[model samples]
Target: MQEPIQNRKIIHVDMDAFYASVEQMDNPELRGKPVAVGGGENRGVVSAASYEARKFGVRSAISGYLAKKNCPDLIFVRPRFERYREISAKIHKIFYDYTDLVEPLSLDEAYLDVTVNKKGNPSATLIAQEIRKRIFDEVGLTASAGISMNKFVAKVASDFNKPNGQKTVNPDEIIDFLEVLPIRKFYGVGKVTTDKMYHLGIFTGKDLKEKSLEFLVKHFGKSGAFYYNVVRGIHNSAVKSERIAKSVGAEHTFDENLTSEVFMMERLESIAATLERRLKKHKIAGKTVTLKIKYSDFTVQTRSKTLIYFIADKSLILDTAKELLYQEKMKDSVRLLGLSLGNLNTEVKKTIVVQLKFDF
Candidate 1:
């Protein structure tokens, strides 16, 4: 039998509208105004939206056109990922100063296991407050923090307060805190699952807790067990401090559908250059290259090629992606093109040889 992990302290820290907040922080004129970060409005998607813009129903992954339609006064800024990464490094350094058990979810979010920390602090809430303050002082950005006994509750609590705030769900308050939480508020429950839950009359953590394991498994398959434990605040997933990156990729969405092989290849070359930059920055290489193509009609296809040796060269990545692209029988004009390098060298190295079909 596995040992139960009890009395653990976890803190989830998430930057508030990281990109948009950075923009406002750097530009005095943009403060307290609606702003969004993305590419061209004609053919781009919103990467992040400010709290002001969010009031007008603007959100990330929505088209820039739709964002502007929703909030006509919204200001759009292009993403500066390199600058964001620089700040992320600073924040991560602060996290390491406290504890080595930090698991980064993205550039803006991370989980820290601080039950026994470098500072010898006993109160996780105080540590969270100090970390948030340091991030604001050093990075000129606000961060929200959640303090709980596990990753699940900590992550959810971090979102309880917006932009610059913190929330703590202590051991004694865990059950009451979760019982009234709407099913949609659960961290892993997306729109499809939320709709499915509604149909099953599962609207809150209490409703979820009432279902037997067998009933939940029958409805949700493998992930059912995860839901069962999470509802009762029994998440035991550890914060992995040294998580390996799975892949390096870059994508571009064109203003118009690309049909000519020459033009499409140009886009692929640029994407390959971006991917190469990312891989080199991280000092990692992969044996497999995947070509992602999204057609004009929204149909998507991924074709991949695996090499004998791990490669990080831009030319090699581009050429391999080109070969994979040309081999596929495209049904429509390509609207987006992306390249990814996976099957990293650090893990059990398998070539995963993909069969090349000239006409399929």
Candidate 2:
């Protein structure tokens, strides 16, 4: 028989509007104002938005045109990735002071397993508090945290309090907390899923919990079981400290859709150059090159080619991408072009390690 899961101390730390915040921190004139990173009035999408900008319905992934329409005063700034990485390194250093078992979600968010922390702190709540305080004091940035028994709940709870706040879902409160949670609040639920759930009258965790595993599977297919288990607080995923990149890629969306195959080849060449730079940065190569195409109508298509030996040169990548692009007839005018390298040479051999403890 399998053993039941024992309580584990998990903390999810997320920086508030990390990109926009970094811009504001470096430029005092941008502080307390609506700001956006990596967007323009005519082209591109908003990568991140300040809290002030969000008030006017401005958010990431929206078009720059829409962002500006929502918040006319929104100040758009170019993204400085090197500076963000510098601050990220400093913040990660702080995490190591508490625990070595940290799983980074992105440049601004991470999960820390503090059950066996360097600080010898048994209370994950207090540890989260201290970590947030340290980030603000040392890095001059605000962070939010969520403390729970597993990564799922902790990740969800972290968003309960925004900017610089922390929320702890105690063992005893986990049931009630999940039951009352809005279905849309579930970390994995997207806009489409939320709408599907709403149509089924599954507005909250309590409503979802009432459905049978079979019923969920019937409606949601493979994800039905996930909904059933998570509603009951049964997530068992561990925080993987060493996450690997499966592929390296770079893409660009053009302001004007190109109908000419010649134009697409020109765009592909530049994308290949960007991909080569990324591959060399990681000192990794791949045998498979995939081409991603987004049409003017918003449909996407991909073509891939694999080689016997790993390659990372722009010449080779561009050559393969060109072959794939011509391999088929495009359905419509192309709006975006991207290239990716996969089947990486950095693939690690998996070795199973026996678990001595299953507790968090």
Best by lDDT: 2
Show where candidate 1 strays beyond 4 Å. 1-4, 260-266, 273-289, 297-332, 348-360
Q: Report residue 207 deviation for candidate 2 (angstroms).
A: 2.5
Q: What does candidate 2 score on TM?
A: 0.88
Clashes of each: 0, 0
- For 175-195, candidate 2 gives per-residue lDDT tens digits of 899999999999999999999
lDDT of 1 at 185: 93
lDDT of each: 0.88, 0.88
Top candidate by TM-score: 2
Can you write out model 1's per-residue Cα lDDT over 126-241, one digit (the tens) per residue? Answer: 99999999998887899999998889999999999976999999877888898899999999999999999999999999999999889899999988988988888888777887
